[model samples]
Target: MEDLAIARACAEFADDKKAENIRILDLRGLSPVIDYFVLCSATSAPQLRAVRDNIEDEMKEKHGQRPLYKDGNYESQWLIIDYGNVMVHVLTPEKREYYALEELWGDAPEVALKSDEPAPEPKPRAKKVAAKKPAAKKAATKRATKKKAD
Candidate 1:
């Protein structure tokens, strides 16, 4: 599969597994080591494995591509799946927090996380209205009530 396509597929698979804070960094211009870095956080070991398995399965089934190397297991807090140009990092919250790949790759442009459905239309903004204090509101209401009573 193409490098960008591989990275996007990884993100889709990770998102499908409900991985938190999924980020795809475009490292093509900045890093010589890899073209893209797909980072995601799983809540638990089981989730981490599920996300990893999903990525592997989807990539293989759809694109006929598999990770050239897989590192770490379900026990480990972090799992790295190296697919040549694109590397996927499936990490636990702790491991993700400690590593902070987003901060580390501050220079690299992040790929937008997209879902299967079409983007929702932006909602129209309501006109801003000044809010009256409770005391003023109450006083106004009392005056209105007195006028009606009179």
Candidate 2:
């Protein structure tokens, strides 16, 4: 499977485990690095391992896929499952926050994992009116004063 497809599949599997902060970053343009980065966090060390295992199991069951390499299992603070074109990071909350993989790879476009729950509609951003020139401000002030007097 392609990296993007693997990312989506792994994300779905992670979601089943209630993994938090599921994100897929497209790293193709960033460097000769992997094609995609799938980052997520679990509550505890055991949960981290569960997610790591889930990725392996789900990938194999769904797509006959397995990681080319896997590491960081001894400590369980972080677990990385490298699936050729894509890499999955399962981390504890502390490790996730401390490392900030999203920020570290800020340049890459993120692909959000879909869930059964509908996503909240994005709140409208406040539009930035161009800053008023000094003269414009003075005129507005004069107008306001005139209106008050009237």
Candidate 3:
């Protein structure tokens, strides 16, 4: 199946379980390493396995596809499911934050899932508050005034 199709399939599969923080990053330009990266996190090990199985089933049953490689199943910490064009990473919250895959591949163009149920909007950007003039600035102004007085 095409990379986009596989990505869509994986996203749909993940959505089925209401996976948290579902993301599909297009990594074609970032690196020749992979075409796309589909990532999500599960609350528990069983949930992780379920998400992985759902993805596999969606690909195979809906698109007649299977993963070319899979790892971390025994450990159940992070599952990397590779389908050549698309790579799926099902991780735990701790593992996901620790690995910071999104930051690792920050250059990739992200593809947000458009569904009737809107995804949680990306976290709000931190506002840069203007710093107040320090006491040193006030003291400097006072010194300049005193010099002018003298």
Candidate 4:
């Protein structure tokens, strides 16, 4: 139960950091060793490092979860974080394409993770006008002059 939660949390955290092609695979019935797999792709080395750091921070802070067996450096194209039953794979686009984890683990059912991020609301645009707005000071000066004449 805790492992599953961690997997979901890791997936969300990766997404929050703009990780692409996020996936959660269920290996509960298929594999005796592992239960879940959270896979995501990063576009660049910096993004890969960011995703890894954010996931580690979130897991440690939120659930008191730590990686039991972590492999691959941030500089590498692929990194794996293992937490007993839940394994997270952070990879570059090239690595992901080469490995094709989704295709390899074709039997593992995909798990859905609900993102905490809300859809961005559209910002209100300024109404367009054919002409520039009248100067407030100019209008005030005109009003003052008219009042003085009266």
Task: Give the alpha-carbon lDDT of every model.
Answer: 0.84, 0.81, 0.81, 0.84
Query: For model 2, how does the per-residue alpha-carbon lDDT over 1-150 read when each residue is reduced to its tens digit?
Result: 656778888988888888998888877656465777889889887788788888899899989997899999737588899898789998888988999888998877766565343323323434557975789888899999999999
TM agreement with the true structure for every prediction: 0.73, 0.73, 0.73, 0.73
The local distance difference test score of model 1 is 0.84
RMSD of 4: 20.0
Higher-scoring candidate on lDDT, 1 or 3: 1
Candidate 1 lDDT by residue in tens digits, 15-94: 99999998888776566668789999999988998999999999999899988999998887999999998999999989
| Per-candidate alpha-carbon RMSD to the true structure | 16.0, 12.9, 11.4, 20.0
lDDT by residue (42-89, candidate 4, tens digit) is 998889989988999998998888889889986779999998989999
- Number of clashes in every candidate structure? 0, 0, 0, 0
Off by over 4 Å in 3: 74-76, 115-150
Give the per-residue lDDT of model 3 (tens digit) for 78-99: 9999999789998888999999
- Runs of candidate 1 with Cα error greater than 4 angstroms are 115-150
